[model samples]
Target: MSTFPGTAEFYRQFRPGLPGALPTLLDQIAPAASPRRLLDIGTGPGLVVEALLERFDDIVALDSDASMVAVAESALRTPLPHGSRLQLHHGRAEEFTPSAGWQPHLVTFCRVFHWLDQSAVLARLGEYVAPEGVVAVFSDRSLWTAGNPWQRAVRDVVQDFLGTQRRAGNRTFESPGPPHTQVLRDSPFSEVTETVIPVRRTWSADDVIGYLYSTSFAAPYLFGGRRANFEAAVKTVLAHFTTNGVLLENNAFTVLTAHRPSRHGKR
Candidate 1:
């Protein structure tokens, strides 16, 4: 069974895109050599690939989920820049092997790093990354854990219907251990730095419902026969906190970057 069945359309409609400044930031930081290449792992709906389409001569986007891969492939089929190529793969990161001489200049894991075997994936990536390449991890806090009143209300409703523990696919959700920074430190890409981008999100009641359905924890199938009732509760909660059918959120998008030491072992 697919980990996230029936949520691909909701994901495309509700998931937030990366910051507009992300490409320019990468441009300044990554190697400026011609034919720059990017490998975006866990590329749900191809958000990172779409954003960096202009930045790389070759882009490979992979996800373990077949539904997500299908969505990304359909969305990213637009005409590309001359000489640029896009490849979408439906496989786990550790199982994927780069084509000969296809070392990527940059490898990115956006929001889905925790879903991976951190150490194994990093070790595997080290073999495929160019010497001057960089690895970046991107993530953001979800509304379930945010401090806003509307967010709290939404979380409460979900828990009331589905119990306290979070659900991911068919199993209970478990957080990956030791933190991403510590894992990066133990890898070949030991030099690490962080950047945070503040984001403002506006949502309507229906938009909030769509976003929840897009998540593994609160997907429509998880609600079973009571999906309509659960949505009603969420809409009622949103109605209380939203003004004129709008709810505002202040969230942070965090980027953790790691790379081999520069000349003289400097960062």
Candidate 2:
């Protein structure tokens, strides 16, 4: 289910970019230094990878989806900064291993940590990160589930077309488990802190439709022959809330950062 074989293009075109404050926050957490490296798991489209290159000289961007990796490669074709290198890997987080002599200073899982075995991944990070490095997990609610009348209307339309229940690639969408704080508290890398960034975005009706397709819950393949009908219905619902053909959303991005316990310090 991680590989959005059909939604890759939509994902590349419509997925939200990381907040503008992200790089500065990252710099504060792990300052730029020579030989610095980052391991970005679930690096959809390489958005974070592209941003971190300005700070880290070496990066390993890994994703479970080949299509996503391909998109990342295409988007990052521009020459990298001098002394910087990026290596892209197509694999799951549990399976990735850095080359010998390569240890990451920062490990990032943006919106993808929930899909992983949280404790196991944190345990592996203890073996991979440099001293005082961090493991950052970030996420925000999807537009369909946001607390807005227009968003509710859109969600209703999606349910009408698909079903009352949410879907993820052919399976029922189960609610994700405990908050990351709880998960992190029980993991090896347990010194956790969080930052919340308020976000407001305006999207055109068409943009909203495109964004819906980019998600597993509303992917076009789920609609089969009804895809056009679904899109039209979504547009009608969105039009009712649009002023000047744009829908506005107020959302927040939360970053949960877990510090890798110092080797000499007691856990």
Candidate 3:
């Protein structure tokens, strides 16, 4: 789990651009209905919930951490222009059982898919989604291929902190999208779409440092929870501070959406 405080703060930090991965997710959800209800899995801090509520009505956001849930609850309590329909739940998708008649029109997970038991999560998530509702999983690709020296420096520093364990399951910033998305192709989902969304993040040195320490990879294993080590690595890489901002390369995102198979046996 990530030790970063205030989950909502991370979303606020990363949302500006932090790799343009949103389009891929947006495209898969094309022909998006005015989603009446959405189930957001592992809704850390609620950025994705905010994203969904921006496009839909009545969102049910989930996260396992109480603090994260608390932060999300505080961040998402207000209604948007359309209506007040967002609900925050503190729980895991695998252990979450929806009451009868509580199907949702859209289901999603932003960056937290990697932390889940993918098989069990998919099986359980199968229940909450309304018929023909879609399941989209998203992640930023900027971690792998950096467009410029600025981002490359940040990537290197963060990766070094992540160590080999985090890298072993790593996918290139540009590739076939999520591994689980591939693993899921044979069954529950009827179609799988992998698309790239190119975007960029302009980071000052301060923004860069916070983002590095915010990552789950940099949490503790390698740094021993000593943030100075993480900060030192960032300083080492960001040797050149130019006005141009970071011309981050391919600092994009890949989104894989697996449309749930219609009328599953479990359902």
Candidate 4:
């Protein structure tokens, strides 16, 4: 689990929200008459809950990082809008223990599954998730994996300061094994479906810099006394990529929803 002590605020400020139609797609998984309960795992700044607040009446937003959880609490104030109940927990996803008699209708992982012990967490979820429920993993193609020139320039500037190694918190980042789809198939939730939502974003040089700070790879603290210099360098490089003071990119956000086959053997 990663802690975002210095980067939590920037993450809250710059992270992109879910696509507008995502909540509707998630809401359709549960029966219309049933009260929808959501367990949003690794819910940084309560982004998922904020987006799906009206759809799910009960929400438990969990994050391993205390600072991130605190940010979420401040952003999603108590007695949430539309009468939703939002509970914030600071704990690791793999070690999470659900409340007594709690069976959430849907459990979600937003840009966080890669940090978890996927098989172990899924095993634990099987005990508390409703029989007809689903697990949705949401993530987007990161700027780190640049598909365009402007993104590549931002990435190059970041690497020049932070070194070429990908960082996850204090450690060099490594992709988790077996892939998410293969891991899900090996678990109780064998039925899997994927949806890719294409999105367009426009960013100013400042926005790019702020977004860089929001990531584990290039957070300000990682620069030590050179943070200011790093910021200046980033702005200089981004100037070449901007058009009318902004940069644009078409990105793909994907959702992987998985569930156990129904008793009737239907997916």
TM-score of each: 0.96, 0.94, 0.76, 0.95
How many clashing pairs does model 4 include? 0
User: Which residues of candidate 1, in runs, are more than 4 Å off?
Assistant: 262-267
Q: Which stretches of candidate 4 lie over 4 Å from their true place?
A: 263-267
Model 1 agreement with the true structure over 130-242: per-residue lDDT tens digits: 88888999888887778888898999999999888987867888977998999999998999988888888899988989999988888889989998899889998788888
Ranking by lDDT: 1, 4, 2, 3
Q: Note the Cα lDDT for every prediction shown.
A: 0.86, 0.82, 0.61, 0.84
Give the deviation of candidate 4 from the true structure as CA RMSD: 1.9
Stretches of model 3 off by over 4 angstroms after superposition? 1-11, 14-35, 142-152, 155-178, 220-233, 244-249, 261-267
Better of 2 and 4 by TM-score: 4
TM-score of candidate 1 to 2 decimals:
0.96
- lDDT tens digits by residue: candidate 2, 1-267: 563657778888898888889877876787345688889999888888877778888889999988899989988768578777889999878867788878787899987887787778777777878777777888878866789889899999988888888877778777878879988877776888899988989899889888988888898788889988888898888888999988889888898878745533311
Please report the TM-score between candidate 4 and the true structure. 0.95
**Tens digit per residue, CA lDDT, model 3, 131-174:** 67777777774343445766766766666666434432222222
What's the lDDT for candidate 2?
A: 0.82
Query: Residue 1 lDDT in model 3?
Result: 42
With a 3 Å backbone cut-off (N, CA, C), the pairs that clash in candidate 3 are 20-199, 147-248, 147-249
Clashing pairs in 1: none
